[model samples]
Target: MEYQESFINYLRYEKRTSPHTVVAYKKDLDQFVCFITEMVGEFDVNKVDSKLVRTWIVSLMEKQLSPRSVNRKVSTVKAFFRFLMKEKIVETNPAVNLPLPKVRKKLPGFVEEESLHHLLDDGFFPGDFRGVRDKLIVALLYATGIRLAELMQLKGSSFDTKNYLIKVLGKRQKERIIPYPREMNNLLFEYLEIRNREIGYFPDILLVTEKGKPVYEKLIYRVVKKSLEYVTSFEQKSPHVIRHSYATHLLNKGADLNAVKELLGHSSLAATQIYTHTTFEKLHDIYKQAHPRG
Candidate 1:
């Protein structure tokens, strides 16, 4: 447990991982520790071996965990062992060179552009403070393709109003500037006016509740879900769907893939390539419809 705590601190303080990621790492480590203690009658980092890690993976598979989930657990174990090796608490890494389960790729889900247009432009959102804020939430997500975490961390200072650009702090504390549509400026100004006039107090943070308190994760989810319910019937109507919609819409309109990757703040183009699959599917449908042979 001491070694685990030290590694967790290393992730939090030195690596500066997000709180959500740190919590996930801690849970994965705890599960691994429990498995080790049960299998060997004791928990000693030095005594762990590749065979034991394989056995743990087998046990996770037996529990009917999905391949992607099992792979994530394997990655967690591998990372933990690497951390131990770096700290000199363990002389060897136990989980190195371990094989992960194969996962079938699923194309990201996205709402159609027409549906989003109806949602945003068809009087779906009311004309009040909360309504305008909710509209902005959906608009900014589609316009800028920012993640939920990035949206939550946005402040007034993060915006370059003159340039129609927003600075987003993405994964690993990397920052990128994304340009929003010019139409979003009106919604932003209106939300600010109502927020200040009604709440009567302004914080550094941009989005706040009716009570002027900082919004939370669940609240953001609820806001997105509730508003999307009026427009999309897709089972997954979370903020990420809006992000996917943003990327898909951009690609369908012939936006450059590399430009999209940079706008999304992706570490590699591969992470941004999934949206191309969605675009390809759209082209396939068009080809099927317009082909002379058909």
Candidate 2:
């Protein structure tokens, strides 16, 4: 337990991991510790071996967890053991050489451009403050490719209106700037006018409730879901779907991959490449429809 606490501190302070990630790691480690204690009458990190790790993996699978989720748990264990090895608390890494289950990558779902255009262009939003705020939320998410947390933390000062770029604080507190369209600038100016009248500028956050408080996750999700339902029949309609649509649309329009990666505040090109699968699917359809051989 002492070693586990040290490892968590290392992740939190030294690694600068996000709070959400630290909580997940701690949860996974606690579960592993509990499993080991139940099996051996007491938890002992040194007693852990590959066989014991395999037993726990089997137990997790029997609980009907998805392979992807199980794999993540196993990775957490591996990271902990690696930390233990580095600290000289354990000489052998029991989590090492554990085979992970293969996970199928599902292409991210996105709203079609025409559907989004229909929703935005056809006056689906109302003229009220709530309507304008909700509409701009959807537009900003799709336009900037910023994550929900980033949007939540957004401040009014983050916008460089004359430069037409907004600054985003991404995972691990990394900051990046993304430029928006000229028309989006106009929408933002209008939203600000409504925001000033409704909320009275007390919060100073870029996005606020009509009551002058910062927006919470559930409210954001509800806003995005309700707005998306009018035009998209996609099974999943969350803020992330809007973000996925943002990346996919950019790639479909011939935006460079690296440029999109930077714009989306991704740490690696690999993380940003997932959207290319959707773009390729579009190209395949167009080829089939336009080729003379068909």
Candidate 3:
């Protein structure tokens, strides 16, 4: 367990992993330690073997944990063991070459373009500061496809209003510039005016609470979920779903794949390619309706 703390510190300070990621890794390691302790009456770094590790995997599967979750936990153990090897605390990494469960990929869910347009264009949002801010939040996520973390870090300084661009700090602190529609300029200006009048010019943070504090994750989720309820009956309505809609809609409009990859701030094209499946499904539906050969 001492080594677990050290490994976590390594992830935090050395690898510069995100706080969210560090917390998840810590939780997985803690769960693994509990399993080992209950099984052998004690957890010894040297005493752990592949069989014991495999047994833990079996236990997780028996509990009906999804393959993706099991794979993530397995990766946690494997990384911890590799760290132990580097520190010379162990000779052989018991988790080395351990087989991972196969994960079934699911298509990303997105709202139809028409529903989103109706929601934004129909004046569903109220005219007050809170309503304007909430509308901009929904619009920004759908328009730019930035993640929740990136949205939280946005500032008035992050925008290039003249050029209709937003600078986003994405995963791993990587920075990318994304452009929004010129039409959104009016909405942005309106939100800023109301925000300044009500919240007193907190230029350092673009979005804020009614109490003048920067908005947090739950607030953002609530704004997105509530706004989405009017436009979509989808069981899942969150910022990322808007993000998925952003990417899928772009691809459906014939945007270049590599260009979309950059817009979404994906490190590789493979991640951006998933939206193509959604696009293909749309084309298939259109084909079924339009093509009638007698």
For each of the candidates, give the backbone clash count.
0, 0, 0
Which is better, 1 or 2, measured by lDDT? Answer: 1
CA error at residue 257 for candidate 3, angstroms: 1.1
Q: Which segments of candidate 2 are over 4 A away from where they belong?
A: none
lDDT digits (tens) for residues 114-151 of candidate 3: 99999999999999999999999999999999999889
lDDT, candidate 2, 1-294, per-residue tens:
898899999999998887778999999999999999999898888888899999999999999999989998999999998998898888988887877778999889999988887877789999888988888888889879889988888887888989889998888779898998778888888988888877677445888887888999999999999998999889999989988999999999999999999998888999899999999999999999999984
> Which candidate has the highest TM-score of all?
1
lDDT of 1 by residue, 172-277 (tens): 8899999988888888889888888998556578999998898788988998899889988899989999999999999999999999999998989999999999
* Reference-based lDDT, each prediction: 0.90, 0.89, 0.93
| Model 1 C-alpha lDDT versus the unseen true structure | 0.90
Candidates sorted by TM-score, best first: 1, 3, 2
